[model samples]
Target chain A: MEGKVDTRYWRFCLWMGPTFVLVFFLCWGVLGHNFPPFPPDTPASEVAGWFRENHNGVKLGMVIAMTFAPAYGVWGYALAKILGQVIRDEHNIIVQLARLGAAWTTMAILIATSFWLTAAFRPDALPDWMIQLLYDMAWLLIDLAYAVTSVQLFALGIGFLADKREVPLIPKWLAWYGIWVGFMFAAECLMPYFMNGAFARNGILNFWIEFLIWMVWVPYLTICGFKAIGRIEQE
Target chain B: MREAVQADLASANSQSATDDTIPPGDSGVWVFIIADMCAFALFFVLFAAGRIAQPEVYEASRQQLDGAIGLANTLILLTSGAFMAQAVRAARKGNRAATLSGLGLALGVGLLFGITKAFEWSAKLNQGIGLTTNEFFTYYFVFTGIHFLHFVVGIGVLFALIARVRKFDLDTTQQRWIESGGAYWHMVDLLWIVLFAMLYLMRAA
Candidate 1:
């Protein structure tokens, strides 16, 4: 029995890719005050002071971030399904791996945000050291968990590179860029080793360059995903 | 089969003549190389900023580094890059023997670079200097460590090129593969030169 495929729903899923990007940047980045994240070497009292002043904003940001965390998974699913179509192998392991990576990435984001939320939940009652510890723990968990997102990009890149079409669904340069971005995430591994320098969680190399590259990659891939869906529908 | 091989050689030469406008290697590989360079540039900027912030610490750390070893690794990578260039050129000419020899020499020299780097890192580690020793050593270990990763990947690419060239004729696509791998190997060399200069030779003040 042939069942009808809903191309409209697929398009909506692809649209979620950008929606996730916008919401994530606003809530987790700007409102959460993670745009210029607290330095790893920040004193416990300072950490507590900042949280005390911005607890409500932090709480709201983390709540919205956690609620919409699954948007990333939905976006990944849509991208992977389109990738399966491009490779003409619906059961390809790389596609599933990409999907799994996105799911785990969502979990990482969710858990990290929850830690921040809990830190904000009782900033007045908790010790300054406790708040600082929670903050540090959240950053470490999110930064070091970069490999999960790397796996997703690598799988997607490999999948796109394997497409034999003369005009591939995803651009070849974008695929290479994705792989390069994934490789750059290796810098995050050095985050735990340094407290203030370039390799630190808040340093230029680890935080600004790494996250900016990832942010650029998401929109690039989302645009490509939208185009790929349109092309697949036409075919 | 021999005629087919000869045909491929002629095609490669003709393609080579017309493809001058195209940059060496696969454009996709170039994309990766360019992005990787941008990342390393950011690393260098940050290192420079840190050095400026603590010039005395950086200068002291620079003195502690073995400059002779850094210079020697620079030469090794230069030599490896030359061999890689030779390999790509030979592949274009469909000279299988020279291609293999060039690749083999490049891979060997690349391995020597790795060995030298391992010894340098171990020596430092044995001296109780490591990534977290200070801002200077932090930059040192992190920069060199990441460059070491690129070198390792370049070695793997060279090995893969050798295996591919061994089994298949140097068709146009295989030639492109060689060029791409050679491009990446050269990039590794280029990055190390900058790293060597920034870390070992430059006066922090």
Candidate 2:
């Protein structure tokens, strides 16, 4: 198995995970004006007003985000491959499911950001209600489609836990942490029912707690993945 | 040879009895538990802020809640937690019958809490109160709803422990599993106590 593996290409793919994270936080999060997202209860006129003022930035940010979204898919593929090795079953159902989850998660980001882009594309001509509707639609899709990402996290965590090595590649504590992170995403289910307060999309629990932990998990996992690959090569 | 065998048995038992360096379950499980507690702490803070922001609404909503039911649920969880502790202790001592019975009792009592919660939630919905009703109801539903998810997961963990205990006398690793599951169940119970205090017992104003 080691002889057949291309370690260099694998490392390159693994690096894409952080690359995806950096680009996403910069493009979708900062420049897209999503860092402190507008409250869910914002009126249509105000929603339209922001879009009118910042349409160019939104367009740039989301377009960059959509283009680089596939980096996440590549990173997921690398993660699944490493997980296959860790669990010693390339054809494991969990590994395959995680791979599919990565694909779908990427699509979720792409489709949702496209909505934001469209909202900005014709913000001047479109009705204020329509622009607000598009904005709301984008948030609903991005936040509600969290289950796919959760599946990916769970599969990876489970796969790591299944490793029987004397010293597992990923620490058991981190695996448990990953599972906890996956479980926390269930809070996103409350987003639709909340237009304000902590359960809402921009609220503390839903956005700050949920997304911040996720952001931490991704970079943490990426670092661990790099170390795990190095260790496997030594073995 | 027989004396040597007895001495070895005694040594093993003594080590199991006296070893207090490691935690109840293992360090990994404690990590999970601590992280979960931190998340719940954040939720509690957010709830307090919400109350402070709207004292009258929170006070009115708190009045509508049934403190008796909250107390009942708290007692139910406490009882279930005690049974779970018994199961873990029995498993550690190799008392299979006691372990199985204790687990069974715990699971049965835990299910009653769930049934009660279902009824409570249904009653609220019948009264036209829901997640979207107001700030207080929203907090009430979401907090309890998330806690209910934890309860469901705890039940599954208990069932898994029961199956393992029924199948064989636990070895060291299996004993750790029992301890870990027991710790998680206790955490669930502890979270409920705080939730009950905040939502039902405390003066919202």
Candidate 3:
């Protein structure tokens, strides 16, 4: 019975990966500004124009994005269950660290949504600088602070290598991929520092390349975790 | 008893042949290592392209770097990598003493690299060089910072390897661990080789 429950939990975890991508795309990709994100120096007047152009839709997008933000916590819960089987010892601090990372990221996403909503809430009466402030904060939260996600992945990667289960949960190499991606996300810290170059928020390396890599990583983790669950249940 | 000994000998012979054909370490670590190299390759390309686009900026920045320190660090990493390779070899032969000594040499050299890097960074900081100093400094700091992080992680892995080696004999898992450690150390060495040439040695565009 306990095993059955675990299987169910992981299935939900797998599902959330795509759910995140969908909600993320609907807001940040489909509804949000351009892919690397709009430049930092984008004037408030331009943002006001966008808000005027897409008012209700922008608000609705932020609401939807905020609603889906808690999916991070569920993902973390399921991940902890899976990783716990391997690092079931008292010294498993990384597992706790991973949970903290997940919580921090979720809070961050919530704050980011608030920033986006503020930009769209009032444009005509508010000063251009105020709207621009909201815009800058939102994008910076997403791109500049990618280190939070990096920590989450790094913890998971460590879990994979440290897991001594007789039937390992995931392949150890996949763990390396997790660690690699986590490290790469650190590139985004340079995003706000570059307004015009490839490292800029809207630039190729920081925005386009890094975001695409993360998209691929989401599905990879989901499929691999799903397979590992199957293997564990069969055992 | 005689038949059991013969069976053992047969398996031992087969094991060596397998070792010759298969790559070192777990297939898992190799997968990660290869992908990591690909990422570095992209960085190299981007850095080169950036240099080409802003030749004067890159050239001026390149002149400010200390090539001698870079060269020394390269040799240090190379020597440490060599020691790691020797450690793996000794572990395979079940020579505990040799393995420990090799690991120690590698660890010491690896630590030296860290110290030298800290000095180099502080010197640059004293000179008012920073991540946002210019395009060249930005790339230089970010690139080297990321690599330095990897080096720190690598040192931890080395320490773990040393502990494991001292605590246990070269069982199958231990053998795999040795391979994985060697693979990781070599990666650190390999990344530096290219970074040195590009950041410290290559002629300005």
Candidate 4:
């Protein structure tokens, strides 16, 4: 009975991680709806038309997306908690860098969602240029400014590597995968170039593969954390 | 009984790791290196594909890039790799002084490369050749920028290696740690070579 109670805390920590992952699923603002946003060279009128046409849907999506603004900080806290399991220090440098990245991502998410909301806040209220400007800003923040999240993932991988246990807190493969996913987000840097090809914001290298890798990172770490819990038996 | 027990211990140690069969460094670093390599390879492949699509733009970008500086950086990295190879060789021979010096020299060369590369990047930026200037400059700034980031990381690895060498001991774990750092430095060099080839040397003209 005591053992069950003890494990519940571990399970709860584990649950916190996957819960944010679910929040991530709800974070499909651009990718889900106005995906690929407007191309870098998208005309102001065309972008204005999007908000005018999909005003309600975009606004609703922005609201959901804004959830990530605060939600990402919560997500980062959950991740930092999990990171605590593998990393020893309360303020370890790598972990600190990760926390910074999380905070930055949180702010970036807020700014991005605000941009989207402003764009959808009544397209007729502003000039086409302003609508277009907000639209571009929002998409760029969402896709290209992924470095914040990527840094946290890299820090997690490094933390796993630094663990001295014979059986690591997080295994090497998953650690490496986290690092890969983080670095691969650099692909978004290319999205501004080719609009229709694989590097396009919506295309494979930048969006599909990179996005898929990111979606996998959280759940993968959650599972690794669970496995680590099993190894440290109370008895 | 004692003689036999000593003999058995010797055989066990011998069987554990031979020079030919042993991995160069810690296994974890290899995983990190391979993943890093694969990430770079994807970018390389994408660069190739992009070049094929817009050969003229890529070629023009390639041309505008100052290849002499690229060549100099390559030479710097190559020289650093040689120093690291020497460091490992000295470490293997149990020559602590030579090992420390070799690693120190490599670290110096790495720092030099980083400084030179920074100047090169600054020069480009001053010329108004910035990211988002065009598709060509996009890859230009992005690739070099990421590579520079890696280069700094490699320098950090080398610094750690130099410290480890200064605390020299010819034990298995220490040897592996030092070797791992050397191997990683070599990987940094190898990656830059490939990047220089792709970004500067290979052009349509």
Candidate 5:
């Protein structure tokens, strides 16, 4: 029989779930206020009104904490810890650190490339301030994913090659799958910028293709991360 | 062996085929972040369309936001993110006291951030600006409000982690908890930095 699931993890989930529901409800509730509340209608005037009317409230803090804490905070840390354990024997801790460093370095380069490319053709399409904002947000996503994935993959690859050990933290197939999926994402990110006019010249494929890929890959990565996290003890 | 590998790959492929609930990469703790981003995307899209429709109101409203508080919050969140990161590293090294201390520092910084935000929101509300006032307040309410909720949850998670971390195996659970927590905290911080520009600084320009 399966043992009892970890309650602390459940508590983390419980705390996270309701707050998520509330955010969605608040967003979709068809509530009033002219700041162009719906997606298609949003504009600078509406957003400015949003800025002008902005007030500090308990709800804001509550939402921020609920949305951010477990997802990136708890889950990300857990992912790191799993990495530390998975490679406990074959490689020293320094190797893990090196993997993390390399991952982040690569991510930074990719982000810089995306920013420079996006800004090159447009000139002032995105203002200096806006450019910086997008740059930071985009990089955060890149770095976080890169750091976590790098360590995990390094561990799996090394373990696979070294002792033929069953990579306890992540299933061998799942780990390989993650690397493949990650590589696809990298290719997708690089393709439009590198391939030039030959493919996706219309730019129509850029948006929809990404949508399709995310539709397939996002869940796969999430499941893999969670399964790996949950298996930490077993490892 | 080949057949087993093929079967595993098949299962993985089939698993990602569905488009219902949350996406696969957004399970467990990340469920909230994914949902939060979607909600924010909706808000952003709304903002974009609204700007297209009524450039005047959006621009005027932009002139009124407090850039100072936005900057302050950015700094606070960034600082808390640093603490959280430190906590994760400390925990991974099996330094229980350091883990607790680091988490405590993060929690304290987070609370300070909430307090400042609360004061900021209350002051704005007192000034007669709120969600019901216009589209701007609506987003102000929705976006900042959502961000605030995330802040609170981050604190709670820190507390929970602090409480139970002592008992768990340092190698497996403790460090991951801290790392994920820090990453989420950093996202919040990062979002605020964006908001600072879009809502506040962008207006000045």
Candidate 6:
């Protein structure tokens, strides 16, 4: 049993190792670069100057939407599992539907409200064209909701399946997988807010925290998932 | 050993065929769906930001669109989606005839949508409102054009499924695929509903 557990751990580390590597590179490559020293007064011209220095917001937006969002697809699956349980407990199909709707509505309202904090939202921080492009991508509020719902569903599905005496649905590794997956998703939603200094100065720490988490978590969960698949096939 | 292995493989394949074998929904498919949705969402975001940048231009362009046609298309698509949903249920019951008929109805409605969209595009084109005319017109054509592309693909899939009706054994795997495909088509239809409201009804807003 101990050997099996360690094997799963090793497998998880192997799978998530790349995600950690990417996160490390991103942190080092992006945050490590010498930013033209912070301006004391962010003049409109100075801001424009700073923006001109960077690739457009459109590029940045593309990076966020394409690279970042899809990377968290598994997390979305996990979150869907969790949310599905909450929905199931409600017992009314309409209420369950409404709850899903409410969760989506809440996420949208929050994200939109975040945008209103333009000082931090910094549409100009990225390139202008990219920002406009990202702006277009941002309308995918339902997609975001789906991502969140998916994670919720996965979490709940595992638990629900485990309860059935018949299929040994929740593999031993999955519980560990769940914690990490949950962390990644929570990070996805919270990182945006924190990245823009919504919480505190030097919120760059959030990035570092996420990087550290991914380094350990991504490979671990991936391995666990693959193993789970193998076990099911073997059975 | 080789013969034994071949026999084992055949058994596994046949078991997969005959049994309740819904491909797990937790796969790459949802990722693709979300990514596609994001692409469309990006377009919507573009619309919102453009409106922010040039509300007057967008408002004027929207004003030029016919609300009545837009509403009619919305109802047609919605009805089509309902038919597709019914087809999914019928397919589950192994009602091949009902599935084919339902799929045909859905396809017909989808084609009608394409025709109406073509007419709408042409009307705009005739009125000097090509993509190059203005930013609003640019988005108008782009959004509707992309949606029409999805509709075309959906119709193609429905047609392909109709043809496959003869071979499709009523089984879990097939059901899951059809259900998801139908769900996706319905989503496309539902999205048009919102687009119609935003484009036509709220023109004055």
- lDDT (Cα, 0-100) at B95 in candidate 6: 76
For each candidate, the DockQ is 0.73, 0.76, 0.52, 0.33, 0.02, 0.01
Tens digit of per-residue lDDT, candidate 3, span A1-235: 2443346557876687678778868885667663546676677688778876776787888888888888876776567666766575424788877777777888898898888888778766777778777888888887766888888889888988887866577778788888878878888777777767778887777877788877887778778777877766775
Error of 4 at A195 (Å): 8.3
Top of the candidates by DockQ: 2
Q: Please write out the lDDT profile of model 2 over residues A129-218, one tens digit for every residue.
A: 999899889999999999999899889888888889988888888888888988999999998987887888998889999888888887
User: Comparing to the true complex, what docking class would candidate 6 get?
Assistant: incorrect
Compute the DockQ of candidate 3: 0.52
Quality class of the docking in candidate 1, CAPRI style: medium
Q: Of the pair 2 and 5, which is ahead by lDDT?
A: 2
Instruction: For residues A160-186, write the lDDT of model 4, one tens digit per residue.
Output: 777777778788778877876786787
- Which segments of model 3 are wrong by more than 4 Å? A1-6, A85-97, A163-167, B1-21
C-alpha TM-score for every candidate: 0.93, 0.94, 0.88, 0.79, 0.43, 0.46
Best by TM-score: 2
For B96-163, candidate 3 gives per-residue lDDT tens digits of 79889999999999999999999999999999999888878877887788788779988998999999
Q: Output the worst ten-in-a-row residue range by lDDT, candidate 4 chain A.
A: A1-10
Pairs with steric clashes in candidate 2: none
Cα deviation of A212 in candidate 4 (Å)? 3.6
Interface residue Cα RMSD of candidate 5 after superposition: 12.7
**Candidate 1: true contacts recovered, fraction:** 0.76
Best-to-worst TM-score order: 2, 1, 3, 4, 6, 5
lDDT of 3 at A176: 81
For residues B40-157, write the lDDT of model 6, one tens digit per residue. Answer: 6756776777789888888888889898889889988988998898787677666778888888999888788888888888888888778657767766665676677667768887
lDDT per residue (tens digit) for residues B1-205 in model 4: 9999867555534222334565777776777788778767877777877788889888887888889999999999999899988877667666788878888899898788988888998998898888777666766776777778777877887788777767667666666777878878888888888888888999675
lDDT of 5 by residue, B1-205 (tens): 9999867555533332233553333132354354445545655666666667777787788777777787888888888888877776666556778878888888898888888888888988898887656666656665677677667767887888888776676654445556656666776787777667767765522
